[model samples]
Target chain A: MKISKEEVEHIAKLARLEIDEKEKERFAHQLSDVLNHMEKLDQLDTEYVEPTSHILPIHNVFKGDEIKEVFPMADPLSNAPQKDHGHYRVPKIVE
Target chain B: MDYEAIIGLEVHTQLLTKSKIFCSCSTQFGAKPNQHTCPICLGMPGVLPVLNRDVVEFTIRTALATNCRIAPSNRFARKNYFYPDLPKGYQISQYELPLAMDGYIEIGSNETKKRIGITRIHMEEDAGKLIHGENLGHPDSSYVDFNRTGVPLMEIVSEPDIRAPEEAREYLLKLKAILEYIEVCDCNMEEGNLRCDANISVRPEGRREFGVKAELKNMNSFKNVQRALEYEIKRQVQTLEKGEEIVQETRLWDVNSERTISMRSKEEAHDYRYFPEPDLVPTVISEDWIEDVRSKLPELPDAKKERFVREYGIPEYDAGVLTSSRSLADYYEACVRLFPNPKIISNWVMGDILRELKDDERGISECPITPGHLTGMLRMIEDGRISGKIAKIVFEEMYRSGKMPDEVVKEKGLVQISDEGELLIFVDRVIEENPDMVEAYQKGKTKLFGYFIGEVMKASKGKANPALVNKFLKDRLDCNV
Candidate 1:
């Protein structure tokens, strides 16, 4: 299925990307190429082929249902661009 | 203009594996914004994806639990997209070939069992979480937390077979129960471990063709799932009645407004640009491998429910409730193994024990009173050492103080006053004071005989064995009054 230029522009807006008109046209073509490949599966004889959802035959995998240790905040906050004490410091959250 | 709503659910559950689906990054929730991530999950350049073996096993286990046929050869595809939280730009998911398919789960009470069809269960990696905030008169830009990115997820999609809101809730609950029973997923909605998106459409009665369906997202709980579906159904039915077209789109459930709002026009499957992944090879599951996994499968909820009914002589409803969780069922069976009275254990677990645990915000796994203690309490009641009411009081103490049932009974001096001679003395006093009730009892108002038993129990400080009190009160009242 071919995605129109206008649809590509609309999708780019929804995704919050600042794209030029040329890039939009390029993406439209690239996306259609990918979808065309996926569409090839439709031509295969799948009437007798079962769609697989999982690969293994196992079931009922669980932990011991015990509440374990909470995640340490220091580890995650260290990667943030800015931090105040242990909390992540972002741009002013409120006006 | 009679109409009916047909609903289906697509549930995405992160498997409880130690690592990510294709990397060694720990699959831990709530890590500092991105502490659990590595290069593979971060989508850094020069990285290759390695499929997690445990993920395949967990997915297979879920398939077996749902009675799905596992495909012998399955592979992953890259679902190409460009979202901020998706660091890789494209998510590796099963598209052309999934792991399992065509399973069904039965829901509703035994008298009205409805089979809900499961379409497929596919494995994928989770995207990161986006935290939205307020800033400068407009919604602030989002903060991406990669802690959840690349976590192994199983997306179980169901056929559009549900008809009502209650049935939808039941289907989710039963599916969650089965997942929990098999230990595939924690199924915790509060922690965002398991989430569901709903697809709903309405049709005129007896119509073979379906109306335009809306996909609802951002429902945080099962109640929200049902309510959102109900609201959408009403909205769609009203739109059709007005002779208007229902747009097929992705909608967000504004939980506060209790309505659905269009997030965006629905994207077709082609939008994903899915292709077979080149870095990984197709998984070939051998017959012996399938057999090995199958042999390790535990007795699932349905089988255990049936066993509880047949072996313990309990009602199907009670069996279902007790066997809803593996831990609860194990707890119940352990109590029976200690006491060997199915009816009595069922009553205790379903009635007093469950009530106490719920009041304390505890599950069976967190319950302080072990099966041994419960069985001991039941034994005391059966041996006439404590009245049923006193047993309840001791149970509360046992749960609160982590004391054994026998210890609590002894510490509280809650032994039953079963001495016939002692009960006779109390019965004499009741017969004298309530001469009117005695007269009424002698004059064939025999049901009023319970008044004497009540008085005797009160006189004995609620410790008098009820059966003994009843016998003494009846004999004394019959002869003297």
Candidate 2:
């Protein structure tokens, strides 16, 4: 499972990350090494065992469907990079 | 060349819980922009989310309604994507193992009943709404409203079993009805509580393999969904007919142009990279809880329709129409309970009541006439207090004024003319004014009896009891005097 430079660039575009030309090569190698190391676990044959999704055995943690106090506009809007009419503003997106 | 279309739908229905899926923010629609936001829903760092118990119960209710097998233990995963509306840059959804799977919904009516397989139903959180316009006081910019950011959604995926666009529409209708029947979702398309995305493909006739598929979005109503699929099917068949390979892509249905346009090609598809969420714990549902929810389930449409035919003695078609909505069925039953004449009640409900409601574009919940008022008018006709024609006028007045039928009848002086003395004057005048018709009737032209009845009814202004008028006219016209 070797990762190519072109594949790395494609993934970066999908993630909306801005990567320079030189960094693409280095990151591709690093990510490929990480993936290869994780592949070693596939050697074990444990077909009868059930897959685990969580490390802890805790389950069914929930709260009642009741409304609590909500934060005012000042709480979230204060952290926004650009705010307009009490909403978060971003670059125009078509489609 | 004849080609067959294979269609499947993915529906996202917003649950009608009081709070958000993972937070305590109110999940009400159309609130002021960002008025329902909190640190948890806003995706602030170091903020943790607690699951709402109602969301899980609602999901289980939906699964049981659709005949799905629930997973004893299910967990949520993070679907990685990048969009401005997604403040967390990822949506928490289910993957690999979902809440329910391998369920089926029976669609169509009568001889066309077909079972469409549902692949899975999973829980997820909704993204914020994006408002793009120049009127936001900033040209060439987009505004985001986080009021709907963390609303709970159930993604129901169906297998590709639909053979035509019409079947696809029927499948959606049945699915929506079931969701509303259980009161899990409001199923309002206008309010964005329910949305659908379709996957469509066309292959040569008698071929077992499927052709390249295209995903369609942006259909705001069920009618649009059918029209879009119809257009996409034709487009795919024409492309294949021209010896061109079909390109896999995602298309948006343009309502004004009535055509599907490509939004993104398969090359730009996202990987998603789903992984289990560590913030929330997995849900372990016990058998006792499942049985409890099952016992509390309401009578579904199919069972209710069957009972209406057996118990109420109404035809299957009338039962189908009456039981289409829960509120409408309740209204029909209430009228039947009071009137105790199933066929007559069915006629009034299916005929005049439905016609007036359709004209006004209103649903049964917004109907002006209550069950008691409607039965009151029927009782007037039954007891000979008002003629059938006069009852119609009373019904119209009651609908317009929201008054009781008795009140409308009394105010308009619409009592039937069943008394012999009151009707005798109009009957005598009608016989005397038409001497030629009277001679014809004496000459044994028996069909002229209808003409006399018409003349008498006209003179009485349609307030005469038809049965009494028939008897009175026959007795008078038969006499020599």
Q: Assess the local accuracy of residue A72 in candidate 2 as a C-alpha lDDT between 0 and 100.
A: 52
**Model 1 DockQ class:** incorrect
Which candidate should be chosen as best, given TM-score against the real structure?
2
Worst 10 residues of 1 chain B by lDDT: B133-142
C-alpha lDDT of candidate 1 relative to the true structure: 0.82
Per residue, candidate 2 scores C-alpha lDDT tens digits across A10-33 of: 898878889998999999899999
Model 1, span B1-481: residue lDDT tens = 8999989999999899887777777776666667776667778788887778888888888888888989987888988866667877899999988999999999987789889999999999998865654421224445667778888899999999999988999999999999998788999876788899999999999999988898889888988988998899899999999999999888898889999998663464337768877667777777887888889999988889999999999999999999988999999999999999999899989998899888877889999899988888889888999988898798889888889887887888889987878877887887788888878888989888666777788888999889888777767766764
Instruction: Look at candidate 1 and tell me the lDDT of residue B470.
Output: 79
Least well predicted 10-residue stretch by lDDT in candidate 2 chain B:
B263-272
lDDT of 1 by residue, A36-85 (tens): 99999899899997655445554333233222233334455555575443
Best by DockQ: 2
- Whole-model lDDT for model 2 versus the true structure? 0.90
Candidate 2, B1-481: lDDT as tens digits: 7899999899999999999999999998878889899989889889888888988999999999989999998989999887889989899999987999999999766677789999999999999999885869677889999999999999999999999999998888888888988999988876789999999999989999999999999998999999999999989989998899988888999999999999774446468888989898999899999999999999998889889999999998899889888889999999999999999999999999999999998998888999999999999999999988888899899889999998998898888899999888888889899999989888978899999888888888888888988988888888764
